[model samples]
Target: MAVAYVYGAESRDISAPYSIWKVVGSLLFIIAFIPLTLWLVKKFQLAQMKLSQSEIKVVSVQSLGTKEKLMLVEVEGERMLLGVTSQSINHLKSFSSNARTFATMMDEASSPETPSSTEEKKL
Candidate 1:
C-alpha cells in the first residue's frame, strides 16, 4: 500500500497501473512470507500443543543439539515430537496440509522410556 501510494503520488495518477516488476515484487514478497509464515504457524502449533494437553508422558528424551532435548508422546493413536529446553517446549513434526494421523511407530520405539509405577516405590 505504501509503495503503491508513493507511485500514485509521483505519477499523479489515481489509478497507478501495476507493472510486471511490481507483480514480481509482490510474488517475491509472498514467496518470502511462505517460510516466515510457516515458522510463525509452527510456533503457534507448538504453543497450542504444549498448552492443549493436560500432561505429556515423556516417551523418550534425547539431546537435540547441545542443550535441547527431544520428547515423544502418544494420544488418540498419534505420535508427536516435542522439543524441550530450559525455557520452553517446541513441537517439531512434518508439515501436513490437512488433518491426518501420522504413523510414527519407529519414533516411538526408538524413544521409549522405562515405564515407572504411579504408586509409591518401595525403596
Candidate 2:
C-alpha cells in the first residue's frame, strides 16, 4: 500500500501542465530587452555629447613634457595662449580678434607713399 501511494504521488507530479505560452513569452521578453537597453544607452550618450558642445575652440596644442602642454584657444572672439599642466592652467598671452594680420602690415609697408602724404609729413 505504501509503495502504491509513493507511485501515485510521483505520477501526479509528472502529470502537471507545461505551458508553452509562458516559455514563449519569456523568450520574447529577453529578445526585446537587449535592443531596448542599447537604445537607451545610445540616447543618453547623444545627449551628453550635445551638452559638451560649446563656443570655445582649441586652435593648437604642443606637448612640453610628459604632463605639461601649451594650448592655444579661442573663445568669444579672443585668442589665448595657455600653459597647461596637471596642477594648473596659466595664461601666457592674449590676442585681440580684430588685430590686423602680418600680411596686411607688409602690404602697407611695401606700397608707394602718395605725394600728398609725403608733402604733408614734410610740412
Candidate 2 local lDDT, 34-67, one digit each (tens): 9999999999998987799678978789999999
For candidate 1, the lDDT comes to 0.69
TM-score of 2: 0.39
Per-residue accuracy of model 1 over 39-115 as CA lDDT, tens digit each:
99999998987888654345556787777888766555455778889899887863332434345656676676544
RMSD in order of candidates? 16.9, 12.4
The clash count for each model shown is 0, 0
Give candidate 1 regions above 4 Å deviation.
1-18, 61-123
C-alpha lDDT of candidate 2 relative to the true structure: 0.86
Per the 3 Å backbone cut-off, how many clashing residue pairs does candidate 1 have? 0
What 10-residue stretch in candidate 1 is worst by lDDT? 94-103
Q: Return the TM-score for each candidate structure.
A: 0.33, 0.39
